[model samples]
Target: MAFPFTPSRPLWLLGCGNMAGAMLSRWLESGLDPAAVTIVDPMRTDAPEGVRLCAVPPADEPAPAALLIGIKPQIFIETAGTIDALTGPETVVISIMAGIDGATLGDRFARAGGIVRLMPNLPAALGQGASILHICRDGANAHDVADALARPLGLALWVDREALIDAGTAVSGSGPAFVYRFIDAIAKGAEKLGFAPDQAAALALATVGGAAALAAASDVSPATLADRVASPGGTTRAGLNILDADQSIDSLVARTLQAASDRAVELAEMARN
Candidate 1:
């Protein structure tokens, strides 16, 4: 579907690496006008048809309506000065870099209209990603612009407090990797049960995919669905018993998320320093 909201000025992408490239590709596929987009990435070789690609910002162009920052957090401070000229009081800044807080972005791009921190996973390349947004200021236009840009990428959610963003980073931003690990473990378990390597991998992947699809389509909670599947005294219940015993699975997952969230806080502190 086409993005319904239009920005007052053109949009500029500060970097076009993997994450930014995914977002750009999805935006173009969703009917965004390529002519309205500009990319500034020294390493990028090209851009979508009708889109302009430049190693540096154009000297004469006016500040863009929205500037999406997709550079690495480690180099953001070093690179912030270089892009300062592109931000103005009317320009909105959106960042997808992990750990950099909205306050820091606001300080770096002080003249921009607003700042938004977005955490998106790698799945965005397939347009099935989950994104969490945290706006630094209160403005309908800024929020609308962000929503417009995020909707095509997949599930888009907004948090009231910026601190919650770290929690989101742990859950949604780092979630795909955890899911992938789970899938790999399942495949290994199947192989251990005598299934051929290739067959085990396929079965594990299909089982996860089908279960996720079913959960998405169903009205009941996943726990309810799980209960429904584990018929009284059945094999499914036998496996679930092990997983639920002493809440082992739950504790493991909680610890994993905590570690990720803690790291996000550390990164934010690093950015501040």
Candidate 2:
């Protein structure tokens, strides 16, 4: 319930790939001290100035205040050995690794003072991202510490029931891919109807982007917006009718989310066991 965090403490990031790199870019852009970060990735040779980056641990760097694990979920077992210096009672572990629950992560990094599982999407590269955080009710963690980790990146919220986080992941974490697929389908439809492939692709992409922006800014639901676009039994409504017929589109998306959520649940089981 109570949140506590010291703003002055340093934050270190491990595994700076696309997602984690995006988060660090946001932090640096937001004017957080780049000096506070140390990135250890065997592949990345350079980071922005004022930040220390290396392929392996430096011989004598002091322990970090917060250690964020951004490695792929499947490879967390490799982190099992980097315990003594990286995780301890003073260090808070912020895990961005998907599928691994807080309990399992805590077990992997037992020296951590507190463990929090944060699920974030790729849009974190910009300031627009959806992040879902899960912290156990009986935990020793502090909410403000989680905020300190979350607030800098983007739109952050907590899920009361951890089980729902997989739903959140299915919708937000993996939603971009789904949207892209939709866009491609639309473009392909246009091409089949005789439009040039390049123009069709561009039009579909712009249309989807603009529509999402409009929906986000509008007070009405998407269904209401669709009604506003469709004149009395007009073209948009014709498409809508087709999609509504047999509720096929809705059912397909429902199955899509179910499959993704089930995969997350299965991954949690694998990690726990």
Every candidate's lDDT: 0.87, 0.77
What local lDDT does model 1 show for residue 234?
97
Q: Lowest lDDT 10-mer window, candidate 1?
A: 1-10
Across 92-118, the per-residue lDDT of candidate 1 in tens digits comes to: 788888899877777777567778888
Q: Candidate 2: which stretches are off by over 4 Å? A: 1-8, 137-141
Candidate 2 collision pairs: 3-144
Provide the TM-score for each candidate, comma-separated. 0.94, 0.90
Candidate 1 similarity to native, TM-score: 0.94
Model 2 worst lDDT run, 10 consecutive residues: 1-10
1-273 per-residue lDDT for model 2 (tens digits): 221322345677778998889888877787767767888888897898888887876566555667778877767765566743565576677777767776677667756677777788887768778888887422335455666657766789887777767887898888878989999999999999899999999999999999988998999999899889988778888988999899989999999988998999888888887
How many angstroms is residue 28 displaced in model 1 relative to the true structure, after the best TM-score fit? 0.8
- Each prediction's RMSD over C-alphas, in Å, is 1.9, 3.1
